[model samples]
Target: MEHEATRITGTDLDPEAAFQRRLGAVVQAVEERIAALLDDAPRRGEIARPARLVAAMRHAMLGGGKRLRPFLVIETAALFGVPFAHALNGACALELVHGYSLVHDDLPAMDDDDLRRGRPTVHKAFDEATAILAGDALLTLAFDVAADESSHTDPAVRAAFVQGLARAAGLGGMVGGQMIDLAAEGRYGDVLLDEARVRRLQAMKTGALIAFAVDAGALLGRAPLGDRQALGAYGRAVGAAFQIADDILDRESSAAAMGKRTDKDAGKGKATLVGVLGLERARRERDTLVEAAIAALASFGAKADILRSAARFTASRQS
Candidate 1:
């Protein structure tokens, strides 16, 4: 049997390629803007203080990355008729939080990784203390950026955005996920965790920020409650798929391509779908989650074309 080829146009023109291209543009623009903002800080101008910490912070913040979370924020906002420019700062703030987490995660106390995004880990490039402070600064600055006047017009909206981000990045979200991951080492070898436990860990770790990214956009754009809920569902599904793909990639992708060390999960004895269900099954799970993500966007119609493409990219990306 011959399969029919699907035609794509406008926002549907090779969604993964389009997302990569658009994401590059967004990330570059945001990086430049953030750099300018960081330069304006009084600490940067002061030569008497230890600028190494600031430089380490900048190195980690400005390091090249896919900016996936930020891209979600921008694309989701566009689905609600909000312009990308209006959502840039919020997107940037999300990236800041993500970057900070990575910096801290690579520390000796955490993953003890020596490389990140093809560069030396913060703790390796700089001192451990400086890296810790850099991570701390970026985390704090994330909320500061979200609450800035330029990011939001209404105080209530700004407050909600800030709160959402804090929840995602704090103990209830990413931190909690990390705690679970750390605990699972060596213990998950023979333990068969149920679906609920898997979903709980993934939701707190990856889905939390992704959910925040989508919901923040809806909140900022003043989207309807139904639309917000739909986007949140989409974000959660995509986020889980993203992590699953990441787990697969950890086994298959090159360290250079990933911009981070690979095989760390297996080396650390961490629990992942791949470990529990085998590679083929894990891949199938990724596809299923991606479909759910796309289905969640059915309400947005053409307005969600970018997001749909992003969902496809989530399952297909090699790194």
Candidate 2:
């Protein structure tokens, strides 16, 4: 069935409102997809789904957040006229991986946060062991969703998604970035992280999956090489801006406003562009990235206006 975003009117009349409507529709779609994916029934070749594990996964994955990554997947795919159903599958898969990351990130071994999205984190709501297993299950399920026939009719597209998602979530991508972040926090040793290294770390930890959101859309649409490269550049810039904006929020926004603990990055001495360049400079850098991101979409003209708005929103978000 067609999602609500495609049926919206008056893009020329009120672009911002139109964008918000589209984003809301995609968020709702993602929420519904996650619930179905986390159902108690076991799929083919799988053993029984443990009650507690599935509950923990559902608790972490559902009922919160903007679902920005999924929005990117669906919106970018729409650029090439891929149907909402095909793109929504990829969106849900990406969100599953993102949800798993947050579960792991909030563990005692990592950020150790008690709250997430204004509620108790998975580890706090459930036991640490259950949280770990839930995260593992979510990550494994992501590949299953990506490879499922619903994600794409072409086996080649499915294979590309599987390979791309693995690399993005694997040792060289988000996971590797987390390790570098830990090392910077004196987990392994007191290795001082410079600005360049911090940028690289954030790119992997936060940016890889985001970039993959856009790239997945391109792959689903079978975009030309030049268009794919352009989207990649736009994705990278937007990802960087997003992390910077997040760091700025950590410094300036309150826990109540952010729906989680604030000022923790400074307390932990975590390296961030905001810390390295200061708030004003970080804001400037973020704005610059947003501008670059918008510029990268010049070839697509008004067709990418919503994407341009997305880049701007990344830099300007309060949380």
Candidate 3:
């Protein structure tokens, strides 16, 4: 996945443009890998076959968005000189898990959204039952993708990938955070959660999977223990900053700009940094977190230039 910058390749381009070219390469690689994975899945005829479910899963997982999590996995893996093909399996697995989350999160019982990435959500495009099943299938398939022998020749590395993804995507991480989120908004019952509780919720719900993406890549590459720890810190800081930036965008931007509904958190009584710290302070905090995240990668030098750019983008993004 290394792109040598030459005059023919636009080495004369601005740093942002050059960086974007690299990012685009990662995006295209992962998208193609994911598509192939779906197309080649084990298919059986009727008698409870998964044709419709596969269709739903494919609809939700492919041809969309920034694919930032996959980029993190690929770039972190590259730090150890891992081949692009070696990283593709894990990158696609993480994207599947992310796609699953979004599918479930958009359910009528969850975020109750009608659109995602400017199209009808899985639940709306198909039916509520199909959406739920598609999400479940995606989550389960992620582990299978990680366990594939081609992902890593070493069984131990493959095992680590599976274990890491489960922990990050499970109760201690994203799903657990979603539970807290639902409760905080009184989906279960009334409860006045404080700033600390809300912050914890955001960290687990959003930050956990992101941290896993970076740290798991380091593990798959067998990077030094110290390097793995640093990447973990970077992931957590960037994850929090990402949520804060999302809050700002939801408050300040339009639905069309975001390609989804905006300004809905307040209506749902969701606790966000902007609500707790106010918009100005939240923006400052996000900026500070971005700096902290970039500092965590200082030891990597220019090898981690893409990661540094990612943190900066997370802090300043409008949608």
Candidate 4:
């Protein structure tokens, strides 16, 4: 007899399997390009002092991630008719910044997660000091990669792109989100977090990088202001929906299903949509946000199919 399905047992139809079948090609192409860029990243020279730090940096950066941010960059660029090669460095840079955040977020002082992407956390696999340095290195190197003029034919446009990325990855965006997350833990104990406040947190934390991804792609493709605005709206909606879905999965999904620890949010007293809204309401909100995300892509016509699929996947993903 065939082995019973593990995580997905009830239904004969597998949504994730179908999604992977449709998205696997795009994901593979994006992964290969990202891997090449990562492999080419310089870790260290013959210099002795920083060699260990370089090695740590390489280890953390090379370790696994979904590369979702980079994929967003590539997909958005494709929607606008930009060549994937032209946006590869920007996409890679986004992934580097994202990886850096994960490394730092996994530290004992932060989320204190021992596992990530089904592997030992950076701080666990490597030492704590090494993980810290690795995160810093990736964060700094992301800007360096983005600023490389050789990647783009137009130096002026490349400079603008670099500036945009810096702003997004720095205090105004991802870093700011992290700061808020750190501050909010256990502050308002047992009080129901209002929807607006949760949305604010989600926008800064999760939505910022996503918005950056779309904006960077639009810039690379020389898209008009209208197109950029539309894409930005799409990113924000889907990004928030993604986080909400994550909240749902954290409560309902098993550890094996998530490939990481579950219920950590509730354990930490963190504010989430599920924490604020009831579970049923949270699921409804996610669906609503997903619909809004898809609607935002309506201006793109058929070219936005990949983005539409991504939005649906974001709301429906078990992982």
Which candidate has the highest lDDT of all?
2
lDDT of 4 by residue, 234-253 (tens): 98888888899999999999
Question: Mind giving the per-residue lDDT tens digits that candidate 3 earns over 126-205?
Answer: 99999999999899889888998988999999998899899989999899999998998987889787889888999988
In model 3, residue pairs whose N, Cα or C atoms come closer than 3 Å (at least 3 residues apart or on different chains), thus clashing, are none
Model 2 clashing residue pairs (backbone): none
In model 3, where is the ten-residue run with the lowest total lDDT? 1-10
lDDT for each of the candidates? 0.81, 0.91, 0.85, 0.75
For model 4, the superposed segments whose C-alpha errors exceed 4 Å read 1-55, 187-193
- For candidate 2, the lDDT comes to 0.91
Please provide TM-scores, in order, for all candidate models, with all chains considered together: 0.90, 0.98, 0.93, 0.86
Indicate which candidate wins on TM-score: 2
- Candidate 1 structure quality by residue, lDDT tens digits, 147-182: 888897788988989988988988999999988877
Candidate 2's residue-wise lDDT over 1-319, tens digit each?
A: 6767778643664667777778888888889888988888998898798899999999999989879898899889988999888799988999999999999999999999999999999999999999999999899989889999999999999999899989988899999999999889887878888889999999999999999999999999999999999999999999999999999999999999898999999889798998899999998999999999999999998888888888888977787
Better of 1 and 3 by TM-score: 3
> How displaced is residue 298 in candidate 1, in Å?
1.0
